[model samples]
Target: MASAADNPLGTYLRDRRTRLDPAAFGFGGGRRRTPGLRREEVASRANISATWYTWLEQGRGGAPSADVLDRIAKGLMLTEPEREHLYMLGLGRPPEARYRPVDGISPRLQRVLDGMTLSPAIIKTAMWDVVGWNRAATLLLTDYATLPPDGRNILRLMFGNAQARARNADWDSVARFVVAAFRADMTRAGGSAAAAGLVAELSALSPDFDRLWRDNDVVAHNEGVKRLHHPVAGPLAMEFATFTVEGRPDLGMIVYNPATSADAERLHRLLAAAPDG
Candidate 1:
């Protein structure tokens, strides 16, 4: 049989607790038996009984509740990845998302998006806010850099901007698809509260938005052909694909590639004409 100290959950908890600095967390230390905080100190920080904490370390404590584990994780001063690991150890799955806004993507992710030279690529938040885009997106799609932050939202651009509507080959079909996909994507990303303000505002402003939202239809933003009537390039058909950013459930990437040689040539010409954008 495995030793009590060999329990995976207990081992993980003990390891993380030992990794914490007692002095940094305002715990006074004169002479300590161990390198890290004592079981009592950890228990005190976690707001649990010291005895129970001891039981947990010895693998005698029953499975800890998610709430208790959360408290313990906070007490340990765990980072997001560490907290997630704690949840996975304590519970059988990861915890629910805390629903924070994504300010920006990492440099690696930005590089990945930027690497798509001819392919228009954009990184968007769960709430459909365009947080990052490549030069191809500016040349072939919308000029995201020129727009203010709020104006970069996919939903806002689709419904609020007349120019965006005119650019779509079939605005009604595209709008419906976007609304459905938005519903599914936001829900999956646990962004309902963040999306609520935009939802309410758009519903009040656009009857189409109100109707589509009420329909309660949901669609996956998988792969599809998008037709747009670009002012500079004329009618263009592009095949677009969506991908979830690795380790980032709150962000999604969409890449659009020209469906035909003619469309590709048009995008190339458009890119060549745009001066150092």
Candidate 2:
């Protein structure tokens, strides 16, 4: 028999409670004892019995079904990633019921990345793992591929590693954007093992990450400016465009190009001059 401490339902409920704000949920501000929403509030919002909800919080309830967990997630106002995390924890369903990993890229997508000769193009997983990159990307960004398998996370590289500061010109903006993007993904995915693992790993490694994660701020990554101190090109100011690969939910393609004609020429010259390694 598994102990209540090992119960995923209880763990999720507790984590959710820590994430909620009383004022945002319309709870009266007074001499409140608890840190977040009350059990009754969560239960009523979820349309579940208070006793049963309590059991879940106490780690007494077994794994919940997808439908039931979805209701709870809705009641808690969880984002997509958060809901997915709730499910992955065995509080709801298996990975098949949730997300599918992008096993590989199609030839068309590969060609697309390769076709952008003047721009640095790359593909990444939801967890920020680099799935593929073009030759131009290698010349533009140094040591990106040299990272350890699990060290490919942009957030981790930016916050946990000091070397990133030298490589990136606007580290502050980059950090904020990445953190916000991560928060957005968390909401979208509902907190799968991949998400949780990344969060845990980053939190443990970086104090700044721990502080930012606790803020509970959420934002999506769409378009942004990328300032890189390219070894060959010198300082390059680029605009980044990110697009989701259709039929591949786990993969996203990001392309970077100079914002101006002059910078574009510089990028072209830089890539041309670089030795084909």
Candidate 3:
């Protein structure tokens, strides 16, 4: 645990507490010298004693449980990053990740994806749902924009789409790797139970998926070579890597760069030949 002199957890708590609009939370016990809710009011919201909260602010309280910190975080209405920061200050590590469904990426993040004109890039949730992609990805990889909302999942495409399976140069290896990595990602995100329905659905739909899931192999999706035989472009070899989206443990971005200059040229020509371009 970080000491008060260095970590300043108390100072952070006081700052956040004082910055809040007391009236917004239905707190109205007359105005005082300072702003935000009083210590007792905050304690009441957090369901802890006023003395304990005061001691926490004074750095005299002992290390608090994750439950206590979570309550305090909710009471303060902390944002995700703010809650994580609180965990880091109160504890030595971050809190366990809570999986949140990501509807889409930000405009700024979409701009980052769009900027990858040559490199095929995609932003996916921990559950392998393709939430965002660029033109290159659509041309060289799967056309995510045209797919139905449920059809955007990579695993479903891998196991359920015949065209998708046909595109893989080494189908068996890639399929196995995808299954293992998917398992690892969901487990790390603490969403294994949440994904049980998908697992069961795919298991029944594809025998290959059933076999792979039964293997119980877990692997990390870091960097690897991916070969996809695009119908228009023929065999395409790309070096693919997964990256964690900053401050979002539930999201990742994958960028696939052409493996060789020839492949790059082929991609460039393919992009140029697209009717949409």
Candidate 4:
């Protein structure tokens, strides 16, 4: 039998396995004795040997590394909190924050966005995909609804789309800022496969993105001043700040405030003229 300290990890793993719904992963239409995934199934999904996984479950295997734990977490489709708990139990420490792509937003949060009538606000995943936005955001930025789902990624639009590139007054500086911030995000995510894939795709798509990514710069998305040539309004100056969404640390919100009264009036006029979608 394993010691008290060692046994909890195994017990936790067992509990997670039992709670996981098999059908969610396309393992449906099967009759089984147990409620959740079998040891072999989890091992297969995690790309580890069945015997090794069994050993870990039996508490005979030595402490798993962080990388191994991460793989298991992904394999099990563990939520961020669950992944953190797994790391604490398995490795005696919490894992670092990672980029998580989330689309779900509570109605209360949407109401908060809606209430910010004067500010252009948008909620984005760690990868900078625009998942939610207020009316002011749609007016200030491109109408997200008009773009393809995948095209809503901020970095992709900034670098890959001609319209976005043309809208920015200082494209080079903004591009650098985006690349640097994304690099830092990737580091926090432990260079996840999703991050790697996005990098690879962007590098191939835009020469500027490729070059900036290779420059190896890193930055935090805190606050910044922006100057843009709005197609209708023209020469809009704004100040923007980013905040982590409450209860969802992996998601971020950017709120753009008008720097001058003139800009505020311009936004109001633009919003008034724009059709509600």
Query: How many clashes show up per model?
Result: 0, 17, 0, 0
Every model's TM-score: 0.85, 0.62, 0.91, 0.68
- Best-to-worst TM-score order: 3, 1, 4, 2
Write candidate 2's Cα lDDT for 100-171 as tens digits: 455456788889888887788888877777767888887887456676766666777788777676789977
Question: Candidate 1 regions off by >4 Å?
Answer: 1-6, 43-69, 90-98
| Ten contiguous residues with the weakest lDDT in model 4 | 96-105
Candidate 3: segments with Cα more than 4 A from true spot: 1-4, 48-52
Per residue, candidate 3 scores C-alpha lDDT tens digits across 1-277 of 3465764888899999999998899988786799988999889999998998888888876888888899899999999899999999899788775677777899999999999888899998888899999999998878887898789999999999999999999999999999999998888877766588889999999999999999999999999999989898888899999998877877889999999998888888899999774
lDDT for model 3 comes to: 0.89
lDDT of 2 at 215: 78
* Model 4 lDDT per residue over 152-210, tens place: 99999998889889999898998999899978766875677887888999999999999
lDDT of each: 0.85, 0.75, 0.89, 0.85
Clashes of 4: 0
Model 3 per-residue lDDT at 15: 92
Best-fitting candidate, scored by lDDT: 3
Please, what are the lDDT tens digits per residue for candidate 1 over residues 123-198? Answer: 9888899999999898777898889888899999998999988999889899999999999877876667658899
TM-score quality measure for candidate 2: 0.62
